[model samples]
Target: MHFDGSTWWMFYDGTSRGRRHVGLATSADGRSFTRHPRNPLVLDAGAVDVQRVGGVWVMLRESGTGTLWSTSPDGLCWVDRGRLFGLSGASTDRFGQVTPHLQVVDGVPSAIWFGGASVVSWNRNRIAVAYPDGAPAPAGSGCTACVSAGLSCAAACQSALGATGGACGMPGSTDGSRCCACAPEGCERCIGASADCHAACVSAGAAGGWCATPGSTDGSRCCACW
Candidate 1:
């Protein structure tokens, strides 16, 4: 909850039809409150945190899949800024981040969230941090072959592995000729395979495919087939 001089605003989560939503309420005396006409300001969002940053309002929420960020000029109308962070591709946080909180330390803004290895296992999770600029990339980020082919780390992972998104394992990573990390889906990772990736896919009964990570003689590579 925050106060804008005269009106106190509160953002909360509510469930309707088995789905979570973000709601807004306002109070004049910090006691009696009224719900905004747009009660559920956002759909499929929960665990909201709103704060005044510089001259605008920043809102962070967990969308189950990942954490999302938004900004508002008056705290009433919000503009989504997309996913707060990308998958690190680590066994600890391979899925995504959730339950986000925005904190400013030494004049630098950062996002804190919880990441778990699996979607259902929360007992053994890790707290992760992400900055406005970016976060540190994880180890073995993505296919080295794809990165060598002049693709952004994230793009390499996404296009090569057919993943939802990707992240790099290092800072100041450029778009071309840099390796990143990605969670593979609808793809197969081959270790110590020297055969042609496309032929291997065809041999495996795929209609057509490409070597997501090519040019590896004795290492892990991936084959993406359609």
Candidate 2:
């Protein structure tokens, strides 16, 4: 569940009709929500998690041995963005990352998932946290009213900056009103700005990284090559 200022968005894993899928609902009070007419927001995908980064809304769903990701303009509709992360340790080598969640600590986006040694570590779940390399933290928190649900302001800000723009995390863009150029150095959840974040990526070894926004063409996006 995530709070988008005025409305609360709740995503759940359940069965509808005869198929197992993910569902969504919106509510003003956080208790009652109007189900989206387009039910089964995701098909055959489970362990769903949703987050808003820069000005984009991203959905992470488990697919095969890795996690599949998608971006949405409105949480109701989605477009595939492919795999976001994969696990390689002995415990999670087989199952990949499971039940991942995104949170912005201080400013960098953080990813937390459940992993452990295959059957040998059965029932012994290990919690892993992934984030940008240089992220400073208040540890698991972000400004609530920073970014809007549709991210209109972020889109506009990025559009105004054009290509070769710096990330929102650069210096003064974290008001949630503008989008980042690429993802920050240690962001596990959010996308960073291109000028700064990309530099960080290159410094981190993704010299030829490719960065783009997922849903909208506004240019407010994250770096994938990194």
Best candidate according to TM-score: 1
- Local distance difference test values of all predictions, in order: 0.61, 0.55
Q: Which stretches of candidate 1 lie over 4 Å from their true place?
A: 105-108, 115-124, 134-226
Per-residue lDDT of 43-126 in model 2, one digit per residue for the tens?
Answer: 776778888876678877654465678888888778988877665433333446666676755544664454422222223234
- CA RMSD (A), model 1: 11.8
- Worst-scoring 10-residue span by lDDT in model 2: 116-125
Please, what's the RMSD in Å of model 2?
18.5
Clashing pairs in 1: 137-168, 137-169, 138-169, 141-180, 141-181, 142-180
lDDT of 2: 0.55
TM of each candidate vs. truth: 0.52, 0.51
Clash number for candidate 2: 22
